[model samples]
Target chain A: MTLDFWGLGLQAVNVLILVWLLTRVFWRPVAAAIVARQTAAQALLSDAEGTQAKADAALAEVTKAREEIAAERAAMLASAAQEAEVAVQAKMAEARAKAEALVEAAKVAQGHAAEAARKEQTRQAATLAVEIAGKLLARLDPNAVQGAFLAQLVAAVEGLPEQDRAALTRGGTLVSAAALDDAGQARIAEALGKMPGLTFVVDPALIAGFVLRTQHVVLHDSWQSDLDHILKDLRHAA
Target chain B: MNSPLDAVALFQIGPVPITQAILTTWGIMAVLLLGAFALTRRLTLTPGRRQAALELIVTTMDTQIRETTGAEPAPYRGFIGTLFLFILVANWSSLIPGLDPPTAQLETDAALAVLVFLSVIWFGVQGGGVAGYLRSFASPNVVMIPLNMLESVTRVFSMFVRLFGNVMSGVFVIGIVASLAGLLVPIPLMALDLLTGLVQAYIFAVLAMVFISATVEDGTPKSQKET
Candidate 1:
C-alpha cells in the first residue's frame, strides 16, 4: 500500500465539512419541534384541569341551592299544616259554641212554655173546682144547711173562755144571714148573756148561717166556710 | 496482475490534488445533504411516512449512542452519526459497477481514523478539562502513562488499518475470483462481500465509539470506570 498525503488531507477536509453541514441541517430543527410539541401538550393538560375545577365548583353550588330549596319547601309545608290545624280547631270550637248556644236557647224557650202551661192548668183547675162546689151547694135544702151551720156556731160559742164570753155580751149585735125565730134567739142568748140591746141583723151574704160582732171579738159560722174548705182542698191536690 | 494500491488523482485545486475517492465522497455527501435538507425544510409536530421513518432512524441512533457511551447522546450525535453514515455509504459503494469503495483506500480510512482520534480528545478535554484528561493516561498507576499514550496512538492506527485491510481484501478477492471463475460464480462471493462490507462498517463505527467514549467516561478507561 502507498500513502498519499494529498488524499488524506482532502478526505479530512471533506469529513469536517460534512459534520458541520449535517449538524446545521438536521439536529437543531428536529429538537426544537419536539420541545414545542411537548410544551403545547402540557398547556392543553393544564387548561383541562382548570375547566374541571370550575365545573366541580358549579356543581357543588347547584347541589347546595337544591338542598336549600328543599328545606324551604319542607318548612312551608309544615307551616301550612300547622295553620290548617289551628283553623280546624277554631272552626270546631266555634261550631261547638253555636250548638251549645242553640241548646241553651231551646231549653229557655221550653222552660217558658212549660211555665205558661202550668199557669194555664192551675187557672183551669181553680175555675173547675169553684164551679163544682157551687153546683153541690145549689142541690142542698136551704133549711138543712142553715141548721147544720147554727148547731156548729152554738157549740163554738159554748167552748169559749168565760172572760171572752163575758166581754162579748156588752153592746155587741148578733148578725145572721136569715131572721132567727124566738127559740134560736133565746138559745144563743142563754149561751152568751144578754147585754145592752138585742140586735137582729139579716145579712143574706152569709148564706144560711150566723155571724157575731162584738167590740172585742167576732165569730164566723156560715155555709160560705164549707165552700172555702172545699176550694182549699182542691188547690192542695192540684 | 495485482490492482493499483494508490488512489487515482481526478483533479487539482491549488496545492491539493483531488482524487477519485474524494470525488466519490463528495457525491455521497451531496446526496445525504440534499436528502436531509428536503426532509427537514418543512417539519411538523405530526410526522408523515418519510419523516416518521427518518425520526425512527435518528431515535435508534440516539438509543445506540446512549447504550454505547453511558452519556447524553446530544453532544456526540452529529459527528458519530456522520462517521457511521459516511463509512457505511463508502463501504457499500462497491455494489455499483466500476465504482470502488473509498474505505478500501488507505488515505480515506486514515482520514476517518484521524477524525475519530481528534473527536476523542476534544470530547475528553470538554468533559474533564485539560489537566483531568491528561491525568486519565496514568490510570491504575503513574508508571502506565507512557504505555497508555502509545496504546491511544496504536488503537487509532489499528482503526485505519483494520478498515483499509478488510475492504481492500474483499474488493481484491472479488476481482481476482471474477478473472479466474466465470461471471456467475463470483456472484455468491459478491454477496458475501456485501455482508462483509456491512459488518466491517459496523465494526469500524463501534470501535470509534469505544475509543471516544473511553475518553469521556468519567475521565477514565472503560475497565477502571466500570470498577
Candidate 2:
C-alpha cells in the first residue's frame, strides 16, 4: 500500500489556508473586541475618579464657606452685642442726665420759692412796722403835734399858687384831730393870712395833724396819710 | 476493504491523483473557513452569547499556548490553534457514517508532521538567523550535531507514527468488532475512539508547540530568547 502524496500536499495546503482565514475572521477580531471593552471600562473608571475628586473639592469649598458663615455670624453677634451695649450706655446716660436736670431744677425751684417766701415775710414785717409806728406817733402829745402840724400846713399853704390859696380862704374848712386853741388858730391864720375864711372842724380820726379842704384843693398833712403811703411802697417792693 | 494506510485515488488531475482523503480534507477546510467567517461576523466590544463562546475558545487557545511555550500567544496562535482545531475535527469526523477520520491515514499524519518540522525551521530562522538555526543542531557541543539532526527527523516521524497508529488502530478494531459482533457492541469502542481522538489532538498540538519553541529557543541568543 502506498501513501497518497497528492492528498497529503492538498491537506497541508488546506490547513495553511484555514489558518490564514481563521486568523483574520476569528482570532484578531475577538482579541480586538476584548481590548476595546477593557479600554472602555478603564475610561469609565477614570471619569468616575474625576467626578469623585470634583465632589471632594466641592465639599471642601462648601465646608470652607460654612466655616466662613459661622465666623461671620459670630462677628455679627459680637457687633450687635457691642452696639446694644453702646445704646444701653447712651440710654442710661440720657436717663441719668434727665434725672440730674430734674433734681437740679427742683432744687432751684425750691430755693426760688424760699427766697419769695422770705421777701413776702419782709413785706409783711415792713407793714407791721408801719402800723407800729402809726400807733407810737398817735401816743405822742396831741397839742405839740398839732402845733407842729399847723406850722407845716401853713408853710405848705404859703408855697401854694394864688388860686389854691384863694380857694382855701373862700370856703375851705380845716379838718383837725381836736379843736385847736385860739393861739394855734390865730397863729395859723397869721401864717396864712389870705385864707381868712378857713373854718375849723374837729376830726379825731386824723390822729394829731390837720388837713385843709376847699372845693377842689385839699392839702393832706396827717399821720394816717403818711402811714398809708409807706404801706403802698412796701406792697410794691414785695 | 482497502487498508487505512493506503489512499486509493478516485480521480486524476493531469499528474496529481485526487483521493477520498483530499476530498474530505477540502470539505473540512470549507466547513471550518466558512463557519469561522460566520461565527466572527458580528464581533463587538459588548459580546452576545455567540461572540462570548467564540472568545472563550480563542482565550483558551491563548492560555494553552502561553502555558506550554512560556511565550506570548499572539505569534503562535494562528498556527497552533489551527493545528489543534483541524486535527480534533478531523479525528472526530469518523463519527459520520461510513467515513474514516482523515487523521487515521498515514499520509495525512505524515503531512502534518512534515508541516510541524518545516514550521520549526521557519520559526527558528525568524527567532535568530539562518546561521543561528543551523547552529541549533550543534547545541551543547559539536559531537551531538549528527545525533541532534537525526533525532529531529526521528522525533517528527515518531509523532506521525503515533497519531496514525492510534487513530487507525481504533478504527480498525471498531470495524473488526462490528463485523464480528452486532452494531451496538462497537459503541463503547467508538466512544473510546472519541476520547482517543481528543487526547491525540491535544498531544499533537502540544508536541508541535514544544518542538517549535525548542528550535526557536535553541537558535536565539539567551538575551533575545524572551520573545
Candidate 3:
C-alpha cells in the first residue's frame, strides 16, 4: 500500500481533537486532587514532629524540676541539722557555766565552816581550864589562902622595878594562881606593897600556876593555858 | 499494475482500487466496536462476565499509567485503556483470513502518533503554564534550545515512522510470503504475524506512556530523589 501523507495529516487533526477532549474531561481534577492529598500528608507529618518536640521539651522540664526539688530538700535537711547542732552547743555551754558557779560557791562555804570550827575550839578550851582550876582550889582552904596571898601580892607589886612598876601602876593586874600556900600569898602581897607601881588580884582557876594581865604584857603561868598552846602547835604541825 | 487480490476489481473510483484488505479491516473494526458497545452498555459496580473481562483490561492499563506517569492511575485510566484496546484489536485483525491490520496503514499509525503528540502538548500546558511548557524546549542549557526543539519535532516524527514502518513491514512481508506460498506453508508465517501483532500493540502502548510522561510537568525525567 502507498503512504498517504494527506490522509495521515487529516487523521492527525482528528487525533489532536480527541486528546484535547480527553484532557479537559478527565485529567485536570485527578492531578489537582493528587497534589492536594500530598500536601495534606506533608502538613500532617510536620505537625507530628512539632508535637513530638513539645513533648520532649516538657519531659526535660519535668526532670529538671524533679532534680531541683530533691536539691532543695537536701539543703533544707542540712540547714535543720546545723540549727540542731547550734542549739546543742548552747545548752552545753549553759550547763558548764552553772556547774562552775556551783563549784566556786562550795569552796567559799567550806572556808567559812573551817573558820567557825577554829573559834569554837578556842572558846571550849578556855571554859575547860577555868573549871579544872576551880576544882583544885576548893581542896585547899580558900579563905586563909586568899588573905595571905593578897598581902604577899601587895608587897611584890611594891618591889617591882620603876619602869615595870610604872606600867603596872597604869593598869591594874588580874592574877590567877592555885599552887601558893597562905604564907606565900601574904609574902607576895607585902612585896607587891613595897613596889611603887605593882598591884595584884588572885583567882583559883589558874590550877597550881599564876597568870598576870597588864597593860603591856600578859604572863601566862596557868598549867591549862600551857597545855592548850602545846596542843595547838602539835595540831598545826600534824 | 496487476490486481493485488481477487477482491480488487470489486470497487473502483476512477483509476484507484478499493482493495479487499481495506474492506475487511473496516468490517472487523465495526464488529469489534459493536461487541465493546454491547458489553459496556449497562455498567455495574459488581461486574458480569463481559464487564469483568473489560475491568481486568482497565485495571492493567491503570497500573501501566501509574507506573509511567507517577501519579494516580484512576485519572488517565479510561482514555489510556481505550487507546490500548483499540490498537490491540486493530493489530490482531491482521491475523484473520483475508483481513489486513488497520494500523498497517500510514493513516491509522499516523493517527495514533498524532494522538500521543497532542496529548503530550495538552497535558504539558495543563500541568504547567504555557510559558513553562514552552520552556521545556530550552532545557539542559539555553544554548540547547534549537537542538531541544529539533529533538521534540524529531521525536514526534519518530513516533509516526516507527509505528508506520513496523506495521507496514509486517503486512508487506506476510502478503509477499503468502502470495508466493500456498495456505499450508504460510501457517508458520501467520503465527509469526500474530506474534508481531501483539508486539506492535505493546510497543505502541509503551511509546505512548513515554510521550505522556515527557509532557507532564517541566518534562524533566523523574528523579530518584524522595518527594
Q: Which candidate is the best by DockQ?
A: 2
TM, every model: 0.59, 0.62, 0.46
Clash totals for all models, in order? Answer: 0, 0, 27
Query: Which run of 10 residues does model 3 chain B get worst, by summed lDDT?
Result: B2-11
Candidate 1 per-residue lDDT over residues A216-235, each given as its tens digit: 78777765555566667656
Candidate DockQ values, in order, are 0.44, 0.53, 0.12
User: Which lDDT tens digits does candidate 2 get at residues A1-238?
Assistant: 7877777787778778888888887788878887788899999999999999999999999999999999999999999999999999999999999999999999999999998998889888988998799789889999889888988987887788877776766777888998988888787677667437878999977787888788897788998777777887887777
DockQ head-to-head 1 vs 3, winner? 1
Ranking by DockQ: 2, 1, 3
| Candidate 1 local lDDT, B1-227, one digit each (tens) | 53378766777888887877888899889988998899889878777887777777677778888888777788887888888888888888888888888888889999998998898899889876786588778776799899989988999999898888899998888888878987887788788888887787778777888877776664754566566
Best by TM-score: 2
Chain B TM-score, candidates in order: 0.91, 0.95, 0.79
All candidates: CA RMSD (Å): 10.1, 8.6, 12.5
Residue B66, model 2, lDDT: 88
The CAPRI-style docking tier of model 2 reads medium
Worst 10 residues of 2 chain A by lDDT: A187-196
Model 3 chain A: weakest 10-residue lDDT segment is A22-31
- Decoy 2 TM-score against native: 0.62
Error of 3 at B139 (Å): 2.5
Residue ranges of candidate 2 with Cα displaced over 4 Å: A59-238, B225-227
